[model samples]
Target: MTDDAPNSSTPPGLLPAGLMDLLPPEAEREAVLVETLMAAFAGHGYERVKPPLLEFEDSLLAGSGAAVAEQTFRLMDPVSQRMMGLRADTTPQVARIAATRLGLQPRPLRLCYAGQVLRVRGTQLAPERQLPQTGIELIGSDAPAADAEVALVAAAALAAAGVPSVSLDITLPTMAPALLEAAEVPPALRQRLARALDRKDAASVAALSGEAGPLAAALPVLLAAAGPADGALAALAGVELPPAARAIADNAAAVIAAIRARAPGLRITLDPVEFRGFRYHVGVAFTLYGPGTTGELARGGRYMSLNEEPATGMSLYPDAVLRAAPAPAPRPRVFVPAGTPEAALQALRAQGFATVAALSAADSPKGLRCSHRLVDGRAVPISKEG
Candidate 1:
């Protein structure tokens, strides 16, 4: 073969990095999970909204969407002759719809969405360029109650989706930045300190305290305050923060209080100094984890809508959710012989059996991978030994 010729051993079905075909029950399971989450949101008065997968680059990366700009995949639109981008996340699209399409709607408009997001690259932990997301947004409200509602709704949705032992880790993304600003830390030092805090490097955080001043001293306290909800809240309360940073802490406290009041049994944690992965969150932010999951099952928080309306939302990763959720029992598949009446096949389907009609006499139930077979116009279980 020539040097440029394709390798003969390479599988024709091979996909690019960070992409794959979801097969069989796995695809169905993800679909069901998405619906389960959407149902949970609908039950709480959140209406569903669907946005196009691609949009003009300018609009797609506007406002809060700008946060994911680097991750978005851009291409030129043949018709409009403008740059178009695939969404890296769904929140910005929902925000855009709410601001422009539904701008005249009522306040505190609750909207939910489910879609696939394509990113140019994936994180080391996730490593999936295309991800399915189902989430909700509550726009035009900045109250602590609104924040609590989103968090609570997310927990309830995950529970409904069968994610067991789910824990919510709440963070104040602006807390560390506010502290650095209040301390009058230089721009370069602020960036360094922020990086240290993001990595949870206690030694570096403490080392920078001298130059960061009194307010910076609170950074270490904030870092240590990360833990179970109650204790973390207490530690955060004890720290003397500047006004801006202190207000952020208070808002977090109120939101936590509301959540505790409703879901006292929920496992909640507070990370006051976590400033990473929340580029647009101006207030409280959170991540959801389940037992046995590799990374976060979901993440979201308070952010402004496209029109600057206050909004908070959460997005669940159905792929991770499926890994965390219990595997659903597979539906029985029934094999129908060729020449079976159309009515009989319809009846089998109506009875909840997946009918696989044989095209030839040689096809058997076992060969068709079916658990049952149609005989005498009735569905009967196929014997394993047969």
Candidate 2:
């Protein structure tokens, strides 16, 4: 901040750093979505995994191929400058928990996490540094069936969250990476080209590739290769893709078929642009976008599903999701007194009430500010203006 800017000490009704103040209704809405999601996760026998928010850089990194390495926040440890970091993503930590920490526990470890991840994605993602991500990671299995199951689970989770008309835009990085390699592009130029391809701007892609000879030969086929599940698969029909590409395609097709079998009428698209980014995702990745928003509302894939280093998993920006979910009933909040006993509280919870037990107006106003959630009757819960 500039010296001309207001001093940090001059604050009430001010926020610090990247933290945000969510009102009761907003908080309650999130809780409702989470409730549905946790039930979905549990109904299918996926065990819950809660990793710590902080970890040593080694553990979170675990020698992986993620953009998280740069985004991780560093800190000096009181004992040693071992360089701790607030985790940028939880998959690597969950992978570690699966592979070594809980290896003896089970096969095909099904795990889900709901927590806030800190990162530095560019402004296109709104530069909102701290985001809440709730997702699943299935380890110890790379079955095509596993891939299908996860896609289904992802779709189901979005459905449970009250997100409708969800679209699964799928892709395989293997083929595009191979095709670019066959064209003998440089790393820097290839990055620029991939970006253009992501934007679906063939003119820019051709310019970046610098030779129409390759791009002209490649771009049309790539650009034309977009549509519904079966039709898009036809684009790749009988073409001999590289081995990695072929495997990726077959697996992706299986996933699409699985989704179709389970949930008909759900739209599925095949586009290489869907792979997310060059540095982050891998084979069989997808983002679930739909009617409410221009950008992706939810995304996940079978990234680092293997024993590879630098694990990959999906993350949902909760605020982004809140923006994407259709408007809900404005906050439903009630007040509860400070000294409510546990037994009474459980009874209220059994009826789907969220109890806010703070005493004073300052301490308890938050209870009433939330929608569809209530304060435990002790505190005066309504807005003063109301």
Best by TM-score: 1
Q: Give per-model CA RMSD.
A: 2.0, 5.6
Candidate 2 yields a Cα-based lDDT of 0.66
Candidate 2 ranges beyond 4 A from true positions: 1-12, 16-18, 121-125, 186-192, 204-216, 238-240, 278-280, 309-313, 326-386
lDDT per model, in order? 0.89, 0.66
Worst 10 residues of 1 by lDDT: 289-298
Which model scores highest in lDDT?
1
lDDT for 283 (candidate 2)? 65
| Model 1 TM-score on a 0 to 1 scale | 0.95
Query: Which lDDT tens digits does candidate 2 get at residues 117-225?
Result: 8874545546567777777777766666666666677767767676766787877766677666666777877777677777788778656655624523444455567
